[model samples]
Target: MKSTEYITVTQLCTQYKVTSQWFHKLHDTGLIHITTVEEQPCVSLQAIHQVDKIMRLHQELHVNAEGIDIILNLLEKIDTLQLEMNSLKSRLNIYDTEQ
Candidate 1:
């Protein structure tokens, strides 16, 4: 594939031999994040590395996809809540400034 700024869906699919459905499902399930350029979905290098690690763990440890999905979902939820907490703290700081 070309070394463009962003990797296209076709390039990712072709390189990994994964179907589009699986790719999108993984993205939606929070197992991977894709970069978009000009409204086109592209693969991020960081996400590719994470996907590779997940694949290795599955292969080496015989972990099922369902288990991986659950773990990733929990991690994403934790990240979301952490960000929310930071926002709430900032809002409280604003109130403190007024008081």
Candidate 2:
């Protein structure tokens, strides 16, 4: 992966004003994926957005890690379903145009 594609754990914690413990907790719970570079932990840039969302759910909504996990899973499912729905609609449109 490109170096630009991931951010160091230290950078994430510093920017987000969260602790290393928080990062470890998220990683341990499988809420975020961490890659090691030169024996240092790094997080994907894509996963940063998810971490932000999780932080909001925890800080603003007072959701626990388990609750956040469930919410994220549900959100992912909804996104997947929406994509499938859009694909099916596009296929239907093609058929309609053919008719």
Residue-wise C-alpha lDDT for candidate 2, range 20-72, written one tens digit per residue: 88888888899998899767889988887788898899888988788899999
- How close to the true structure is residue 80 of candidate 1, measured as C-alpha lDDT? 100
Q: How many residue pairs clash in each candidate?
A: 0, 0
Q: Candidate 2, which ten residues in sequence have the lowest lDDT sum?
A: 15-24
Q: For residues 1-99, write the lDDT of model 1, one tens digit per residue.
A: 334655777677786666767667767877777667766778776467677766665667766567778766788899999999999999999999997
TM-scores, all models, native as reference: 0.51, 0.71
**Best model per TM-score:** 2
Local distance difference test values of all predictions, in order: 0.72, 0.88
lDDT (Cα) of model 2: 0.88
Off by over 4 Å in 2: 80-99
